[model samples]
Target: MLVLPALFDEANKLRRLTVEVMQRLDAAGIDSALPDLPGCNESRQPLDAQSLDHWRACAMAAAAHFSATHVLTLRGGVLAAPPEMPGWNYAPVAGRQVLRSMLRARTIAAREAGREETIEALQQLGRREGVELAGWPLGAKLFAQLEDAAPQPDSAQVEIDQGTIGGGGLWLRAEPDEAPEQADTLAAAVAMGISTV
Candidate 1:
C-alpha cells in the first residue's frame, strides 16, 4: 500500500492520524509506504514550481517505485491518486474547495491586519504570478490546475467516509491531533478490504 497524505496545512494537521493508521496497518502485517510528494515534507523541490499534474505523475512514480499493490489517499491527496490503482479515499475533497478554504483564511488574515483582500483578487493574483496561502506558496500553474481539480472516478477505488472511521476528521482540527479509535477502524477496514482483493 502507498499512502498519500492530505495536502498543505491539512497534511500537517492529519500527519499524526496518518502515522497511526500506518502503524496499525504494519501491526496487521500489511506493508505500507508513505512517499513525500515533490515540494512537500523533506523534498527539496520548490513548491512554487510544482503543479497538480506534476504531483500526480510523482505519485504514480512513487507507487511504481514502491511496488505498491494498493493506495490510500486522504483529503486533497485524492486529487493525485493514480487512476488505475485500487485504493481507498478517506474524506475526499475537491481542489477548488481546498483553495477556497485557504483563500478565505488569507482574506481573514488580511482583515485582521487592517488590510482589505478579496477571494477574487487573490485568485487573480494566483492566476497571474502566484500566491501564498496558509504559508504554502502556490505557483500560477498549480493554482490554475487546482481550480478544476477533483478526484477522477475509478471503479477500482472505494470511497471511505469519515463516519465509517468513527471519528471527526483530524484535518478539520485547528492543530494536529490523533485518534486511536479512528486509526484502528481505518486500518482494520483497509486490512479487510485488501484481504478480499
Candidate 2:
C-alpha cells in the first residue's frame, strides 16, 4: 500500500498516488490495497471531527486489509500508521490541496451567497482575499477560467448586457452534469509550491 493525504474525502480516505504507484508496481507485478481512515472519505464520518484513536482505527483497518504498506506523509506530520512497511513524511501536497480547497470553498460561498449574481463578490475576492495574508497574488488567474460562479446550473453562463465594469463577462451557466476540478489550481498551486500569489 502507498500512503498520502486523503484527497477525495467525499468518497474515502484515498491514497491519491497509490493507483498511479500501483500501476508502476503492477508493471513490476506488485499488488496493493488502499483504504480510507474512519470518519473520512468513504468511511462516512467527519474527519475534522474524528479523534486520533479514530484515525488509528482507520489505519488499522488498512492494516487488516493489506499485509504490507508504505506510508508517505504530507504536511509536517506523517499520518500515524501501524509499525509496518516504512512510514515517513515526504513533502507537502497540503499547500496545493489546501489552497485549492480554500479557493473552491470561497467560490462556492460566493456563488451561494450571490445566487444569480456572484461575479461581483468573486471580483472583490480577487481584490481583497485573493492575495491572502502571506502577500500571495491569487488574482484572476485562479478562477478566471471558470465559466461563471453562479449557484444554479440552469442559470445562464454570463450576464453581459450593458454597464458591466470589466466589459462583458461570462455568466455561470449551470450544467447539471459538470462540477469542478482542481487540476488548474493544482498546477497553479504546485507551480507556486502550494502557496498562492
Candidate 3:
C-alpha cells in the first residue's frame, strides 16, 4: 500500500488520520508506505523549486521504490496518483479548489497588511517567482498548473466520503487535533475498499 497525503495545511492537520489508516492497514496484514514528496514532509528541497509534475514523478518513483501494488490517496493527493496503479481515494478534492482557497487567504492577509493584491497579480507573481501563502512557499509553475488541474478519473478504484461522520475540517482548525471517530470510520472504509480491490 502507498498512502498519499493531502497537500499543505490539510496534510499538517490530517497527519494523525493518515497514521490511523496506516495502523489499520498494518493490522489487516497489508504492508503500507507513506513516502514524502520531494518538496514535502521532512525533505530539504524548497517547495518553490518544485512543480506539480515533479511531485507526480516523485510519487511514481516512490511507488516503484516501495513496490506499491495499490495506492491510497487523500484530498489533493488524488492529483498525484500513479497512472498504472489501482487505489482508493478518501475525500478527494481538485487542485484548483485547493489553490483558490490559498489565494483567498493570501488576498485577505494582503489587505490586512495594506498590501494590495489581486488574483491576477498573485498569478503573475507566481509565474515570475514563487508566492508565499500561509507560510508555504509554493512554486509559480506548480501554482499555475494547479489552476487547471482536476482529479484523475481513474486514480482510485474506490472513493470514500466521510463528510456525514464529521466534525469541522481539521485543517481549518487553529490548533490541529485528532478526530478518532472520523479516523475510525475512514479506516473501516479503507479496509473494506482494500479487501474488495
Q: Whole-model Cα lDDT per candidate?
A: 0.92, 0.36, 0.81
Candidate 2 segments whose C-alpha is farther than 4 A from its true place: 2-5, 8-17, 46-49, 72-77, 80-85, 88-90, 93-104, 111-197
The weakest ten consecutive residues by lDDT in model 1 span 150-159
Q: How many backbone clashes does candidate 2 have?
A: 14
lDDT-based ranking, best first?
1, 3, 2
lDDT of 1 by residue, 88-158 (tens): 99999999999999999999999999999999999999999999998999999999999999887753789
Residue 47, model 3, lDDT: 84
Query: Which candidate wins on TM-score?
Result: 1
lDDT per residue for candidate 2 within 1-197, as digits (tens), equals 44434333211222333344334444444454555555334666543344434455666666556654444332311333443435333332333343455456555765678854344554566544343311223433332322231112122111112132222211121221211232222222222321221
Reference-based TM-score of each model: 0.97, 0.39, 0.91
Ranking by TM-score: 1, 3, 2
Tens digits of per-residue lDDT for model 3, 8-98: 8889888988888788788888899998777888989988888888888988899889988889888888877875688877777888788
- In angstroms, the error of model 1 at 100 is 0.8
